[model samples]
Target: LKVTIAQIDIPCSFGPAYEGERVRGKDLFVQAGGGKTQCTEYLELADMKEIDDGKVTVIGPDIPDMKRGEVFPLGIFVQVGGREFQKDFEPILERQTHHLVNYIQGVMHAGQRDIAWVRISDAAVDKGFTLKDLGVVLHAKLHQDFSAILDKIQVTIYTKKEDVDKLTAKARAAYKYRDERVDKMTDDDVETFYSCTLCQSFAPNHVCTVSPERTGLCGAYNWMDCKAAYQINPTGPNQPIEKGECLDPKLGQWKGVNEFVSKASRGAVTHYNFYSLVQDPMTTCGCCEAIAAMLPGCNGVMTVHREYTGETPCGMKFTTLAGVMGGGASSPGFVGHSKYNITQRKFLVGDGGLLRMVWMPKSLKEEIRERLLKRGAEMGCPDLIDRIADETVGVTEEEIMPFLKEKKHPALDMEPIVG
Candidate 1:
């Protein structure tokens, strides 16, 4: 493992100073994902014998080939191979892309996995920024930061729509495999939940208490991933937090967690609930995979995913909802959560769990239909997926009420959502 820490070779200035900068529409050259086009990212551990270090490949157009404002597809495939690299380390390295991509002076990265959205600014294009520069940045920084555990890095960028689609499908399968690692475990199974402040740069006061079932809001780091991260760098953003006496089992609040949240949030937030969105929910960040909002008129809640650009039953579009709560504030009646957490056993159980999900974007609902069906059976609502309304049924609670009542959506018959 004699990897040399090389200065990142790119035309643009890069560092953490530019991470908070945004590429407004006026400066946007071209973008990917963000509900406009498909963007997927994935990292896997490979055999050292199979991959070459510092190798970067691009499958389609570079930055110059596209005109301004054209949305394009992108797939970032990174392979890290080393004698000490274990499969468990893949996610830990993969998540670094969120902030690492933002390290560039004019680049903006949001979301994660198949929902990734990236923007390249006109200034970056003037500086000769290319798709391959993405590869270069990842290769250099990953090795420099994790060289103790990282040996060789290989990156492949796909700009072709077909290629990006293929990668998206493949990445989704990998994401499912990673998410299931904690399926059988419950929050009650552990006394300590790990804390992930990795996204704090984007949402300075935000802190995620990662339990076995509650994956990080970005849908990237789960409890198992954070555990491995702490092992790699004890002083890093991921830290273990002992769960002190339970103050409220239904809302999932703990004394130790409250204390840690206060200190970690710099006293900006003193406490939050893990299982109830109607109460003081966890602080939200900009890149959450989905945002759940209360549907006051429907006696349930509705969530919109990052990839859906349509109006939700809650009246606000996904982007509007994100902009309002993405700033690391614990907004009651709304919460940021991973899409996987939707089907988890304890997901807002205090607020009626999946049985209370009244609306979702059509694509998101269909994408998770199979899982929803399985979870629905457990909740004794075997056809709950069919009962949930989408944009097709209507994006307003009034328009969806007749539909929910007609379909016998369990939420309509459940206890009132608002006290």
Candidate 2:
């Protein structure tokens, strides 16, 4: 029942759990991106004839030249080709870079797209790790992880500032194009949704149905990612689910999703509301990137990202809330989601949507600030971002009410979030 990625010849230990390990200053040998300088990673689908199989190009000095604990810009660009390859799968495969790189012992990876961060430990350097070795890990892992649709993969790592800067612009453009494609598609536009059981390895009873508006709680798989995953491995963790009938458009409950949840979760859950926070909300696996909880007294909900350790206005810290929200069980008044999902149209639609968000950690708010601004403008609340409360404002419902009233926050007047 266990699936393992093909082994690669490397100098360090590697495993799934190492993906969560942090590499801090004292132990760090070198880093790529992490705000010290520019860094971007990109993947693209190319014609089979366009790829030179097994090629790894390092444009600048290799790992040995990197000063201890120094940060530098890096650009990793991957090109793949196969008879069955589709452009939609580019981003899907691109996301694997994070986990694949992390699987190497002495290495840590974070972020995605044009803002990836990586660190190599001193022990790894002492063991003869180099830029080319990093590419070898990626090349081997990509082939092993996605052999179905990838016939060839070629990686180019850029370390010089000029080279990275030049490639980063191109990578960002590709990232923008992918984003626009997803933006135009909505949950109602697709007759078929995808199911993600990747986390089932950790949460046995968990099954996440990924729609255009609702991403998996782990935040790594979106609709397109799942779609491509299904295409590559129909029998794999990601599978296609037919939307049998729309039971409630506003609440985002469908007969097909309900049935699928019942069967996939081994009948632990039978009903789910995709858009609501307090009514049969979808159950989440433990890896969700954020938690959304209802603040009943304020007629709103407050979300806390998994990375934020601060207490939220709802009287719970993120870790405390996660204990109740995850493990494949649906809990009313609690939901888990991706930070990107916060800007979607169906985000908490059944509970007055984004306007119901009254508090978030300041850091979390800043992380999604641009998206929130645009969403606020769309909702006719041009100043909504300013109105929303963060930790700097208050961390208790009682303390938050005065600020909400002062800013005339929309959630203050919305219908009650609780029955």
Candidate 3:
């Protein structure tokens, strides 16, 4: 069966502010000014009756029987004639466009004079084309007068199970592709410059620079793609990542990164210094994706992810670690300087050793775990992953605590598992 799909562009205001509208008994029809408004609606003209009226019915806002949030599929099937209808709409049926005139032109080429079958759906309501646009086009074609166009159109009210299954499968395949792409991303693939325009929603002045190996503190946007996007839209939402000078190896300091961050963050961060958490300044921002808090005893640093709100030994937020590690924070041992680079020296021991504990979700932890373990083994230390209690890995908690004690360091406390 030939099926045409079109989506409506409905200006839906259904978030927090719409709660008042919902409570005030403002129906959709009422919101649309009693259907008098010329709203853009998408129409799908099809030759076959693939949609079932029982499955795809439009629920009028004024209908008392309909539930408040009831969503009904709005589609209509019309039979014009047989031979002329088949020749006219068939050619344009496969093409996707908002303009009906384009479809008519294609029909004219096929030597068809009139519309044979037309399907109507409310899916494209809020899009650029409105019901009035359709009426105007039909009236101009002399197919039907504007006054009687509404009567000629029949609404198919129910969505067929097969149609739902087809849509679901299409969506599933797209999601699978995305998942595969993410899984296939390599370290080198991820290590590139990126811009975090999304953060502007929370931090008006803040823009995160991402690289391939590193991601935004919000854990979105890998390096290479972000860099490419910035290049494509130079002054638009994303910008370039200008490299700064190398940081002092011994002191774990970078002059260029510090200067850039100080200015970018609007003096929220100044005089970038690695280590020395107490005397040196910490990262302060109007908005931060993560937060790091010192544990009460200072035995070890505890990093918290923002979404996690339970009792942490350090009471820090994930935004803290993400920001600190992203660089310019005076917290000792925190890596990720200048929002662009992810250096091993920044977080590991030698200079910046104050940052001891890093708490992240399983996904992120797994992504970096193997690399971190290799680094630990090279440094003649037990891998932090081995110390952490995880069923997937063989290392036990017992084996990990001894290493921490032997190294004169306190064991890290992990947050409880969240669903």
Candidate 4:
């Protein structure tokens, strides 16, 4: 970390430890994004001649000019040019905006891509901190951390409504293009999958082997995300795991995955089946956003999010299910996964894929309803969405069974899940 910040004068204390501190509404000096306005952060590769080196542009009012507790639309756009930079690394650098900005004292950062939310504390603003300091921190930190690949860094902060709206459209387009590219890719297209041990700091035995269809349990890092992380830091938590052999394509059991997990988990978890929760399922760290549980009565699986407080048809709440399934234990009848992963073609493919999903929290169902409907249609079960039960339908297996039978759910007709 060759961070040289001699030119910029920082007014307040700043570090990683302060990230957990909260800035409640009463204490906040301003809020950006958080559904109040269009907020986006974008990083792009450009020709060296195209940008003014080391320049920071603010297109609207400075921080001091705004009233306290005000809301504003913001856009952070960074363009870098260097011989070593690649287009694939753009999103990788872009993702760092969350952490780098959060390092500023009295500032909080959350979310990524187009839905970034940030807050400034009154304490820092009173100490002379301004929006321009945000750009300075980004410029200095990016140059310091990514100097090997970034020869020149230029940032433009847009606070004006028209400017933010225009930049957000471009940012959203880039986001969609990257997502589609990763979504269309398959495991066969790549020779290696990535292993993420980020959670190993807490759960020592946890290892996440991310593929094209599967993402990190936190629902943040996808295959492309891990790929870029590996390129950025070869010795970091993310590394490539070669796909040695196809042990079971339907179950997504691989020789290399087994070998890596055995070594990473210190032999605690030696066997893993990707698509079936009833077999030797993948172990999870407690950080997973959701858990998939087996519902024997309906011969299907029910997914419950960590935020969901209600019980599921599986007879367990999210907390009970996570406690049973997490801590890097190879437990059949339970698995951990990202919410976005449910729509993938490989999701529980060994146990009938999307058709195996019978129950999920209503909020989660609504969050993923569009994707679920599209996947249902693709699986030749366009009516599957309505057939799947939610909290409103019933929470217990017996309570939901009648509804399943009434809807003629395919899982009711499928083979017994608990053999």
Candidate 5:
């Protein structure tokens, strides 16, 4: 069996009619004029026959299967006598039919308008028809007309099976390439700057700026992706980080970052200082992502992640300490007093250190402790491994100190301890 497909255009109209029940014995009369009839005459012309025994199916406006404003195929099917007929029929059809040619032209034009597209799925070769013969019938009558339409429209075609496979492979390769590129960013790969315009919804006067080396306290976009996205759409939601000038290298302070923060935060962040934990310096916050409250009397920093009930040093209730900390100029590294305290030794030495009680949800607490222990070991502060790894709630200073000692860590020996 040989199959051929063609596309055609049609016009249609519609009207509404109501049906009524016939009265008793009298003959019922129905009005048929409400329905439409073709007022114009249809012109027909004899076209060439590709195969001697082929049957032509003309699809026009008269066809009930045609949908309003939709395009459909005027199909043709042919049964060849044998292999010779299969091989020879297509060439004969090409020399004969103008119907196929016109159909192809109409389809191509419609397709270019992004209106209608079509696909033909038939294996003529398996059905005892020569591909060359089929190709000729398609090419002479359809392919050439479709190509003409291509000149006036934007249409793409995949003829060979291998071509479709190649396209699929290429798409997969592109996605893989993108994924790998994103996965390669390290902590030091690129510097990130973050600002939360989103927070403006709740805190009209607040803006949170984040850096590349660290994540936003709220844990939004990382530095690299954030920077890349900003570069992609500068006028979009996320703006690029414009590095101004180096303020202090040892402390990672920059003039541009400070200016941006002050402007974005609406002067909420005025005095931007880096390093030297004290003396009119250090990062300040309105509300922080997590608050590492320092108990001066206890000489320890208590880290409250979020959704924890407790009294903070600043005496503020926190849902997420990060909510307050998310957009600050300070680094997440400086969570506890060890990072910002004037007397670092007070928190860094002996039984009393910056991090004392880590008040976090059970899940987050475990994650933080595990991560800190690993980082501490890498920093050669093995003593901190046990000190921060074990749970801190309800543990007395004495018990905490023994754990610190067990980890072979030394106590604070600063010259002047600050309250």
Candidate 6:
């Protein structure tokens, strides 16, 4: 193994020990994304001649120039150039930003892709940390850890709103293309599913099993990403598990997957479903792109994404829901999932599928409107997207049920959501 320790030059003490620390409202000096501002992280394969190794650039105002409580848009664009590097490796390296950025003391990172969030603490600022140091840490750490596959790295950190907005649009398109790469395939097409324990660093008991239809909750690692990750490092966290016995096909359970998850989570999670959100659903970690909670009054589920700070019909804001169940626990009637998974064919299929989604934040509803409509059409409910309630419609089940009933929302007539 060709291993070279990273020569990190940040002012703050950097290591995995600080991974779980939080930068709260009182201590937060400045922040990016987390629904406060736009934050996007994109990593792409590049030509060897395109980038200078270790070159880190800040395109806008640095941390020292920012005032406390200010929310600045951010785009961390990483270009990796190496003969061994493949485009398939982009998502894996990009997802590493969550943990790698958190390694810096007084800094907390959550989410992935366009919904990524970063908070810099007053402590880190006092220690003379800058946005440049984030680039420095990621550049050094990526090279140090991925030396086998990459040879050159360049990072650009953008704080300008215009620049970040453009990157967010471009990044979202790339994400869509990457996600569709596995759209035509199904879980039964292959005898194996991959495991993603990447978030285990923060949510120690969380074990994310990536099937063809269900992507990782963080919205970064899909089945293809995990498979590629495993191919690169056989003994790494993304290992393949053969689909053994079909213990419960309705809920999408496999005997081999249960055994693997039980051992991997140290027995914290013995089994979970790939298709159902209300029954033994997969463990949720804090970085999920969105969360779904059952709303009994509406006789359906309400979902809230990290970007939507508004109150959901379930009576919890995005941050509150994440705080309560996002700690690597299996909570019935609640499950964390990727935004892309929301439109997938098997999303909550065991609980009557997309027709059961009664409410979502307006922003989230519009963001996935295209795919949502497509999935709705497949279920023979072309107007389901319009029928779904949002914050504008009402933020409480009782308030939304009237509208749902008037609009003839499908969930009202479905089977009971809670057993």
Highest lDDT: which candidate? 1
Model 2 TM-score is 0.78
Instruction: List runs of model 5 lying over 4 Å from the truth.
Output: 1-194, 271-289, 298-300, 310-317, 320-363, 389-419
lDDT of 2 by residue, 1-419 (tens): 11234677777776686765667678899998855677788888877687787789998878888789688889998999877688888877887787788777788876666556789888789898887877788788888877767788889999999999988889867755654556768998999988887666446678889999997776667888888787777788788889789999998999998899889989988989999988989887666778899888888988998667777888888778877767778888899987778888899999899988898888877877888899999998977889988888889998888999999999878766776
lDDT, model 4, position 315: 79
Q: Output the TM-score of candidate 5.
A: 0.41
- Over 1-419, each residue of candidate 6 has an lDDT whose tens digit, in order, gives 33365579999999999999999899999999987788999998888899888899999999988998889999999999888888999999998898999999999998889888899999999999999998898889988888889888899999999999998888888898899998998988989999999888878999999999999988899999999999888899999999799898889999999999999999989999988888999999998989999888778888898888878888889889999888899999899999999999999888889999999888888888999989999999999999998888888888888899999999999988876
Candidate 1 segments whose C-alpha is farther than 4 A from its true place: none
User: What TM-score fits each model?
Assistant: 0.98, 0.78, 0.41, 0.73, 0.41, 0.97
- Worst 10-residue lDDT window, candidate 2: 1-10
Q: What TM-score number comes out for model 1?
A: 0.98
Which residue pairs clash in candidate 1? none
lDDT of 1 by residue, 113-148 (tens): 888889999999999999899999999999888988
lDDT of 3 by residue, 355-396 (tens): 354333344346456555665565455555444322232123
Q: Give the number of the best model, judged by TM-score.
A: 1
Which of the two, 2 or 6, has more lDDT?
Answer: 6
Q: What is the C-alpha lDDT of each candidate?
A: 0.91, 0.82, 0.33, 0.81, 0.33, 0.90
Give per-model CA RMSD: 1.1, 4.9, 16.5, 5.0, 24.8, 1.5
Candidate 4 overall lDDT versus native: 0.81
Q: What's the CA RMSD of model 3 in angstroms?
A: 16.5
Error of 3 at 58 (Å): 15
> How do all the candidates rank in terms of lDDT, highest first?
1, 6, 2, 4, 3, 5
- Worst 10-residue stretch by lDDT in candidate 6? 1-10
Better candidate by TM-score, 2 or 6: 6
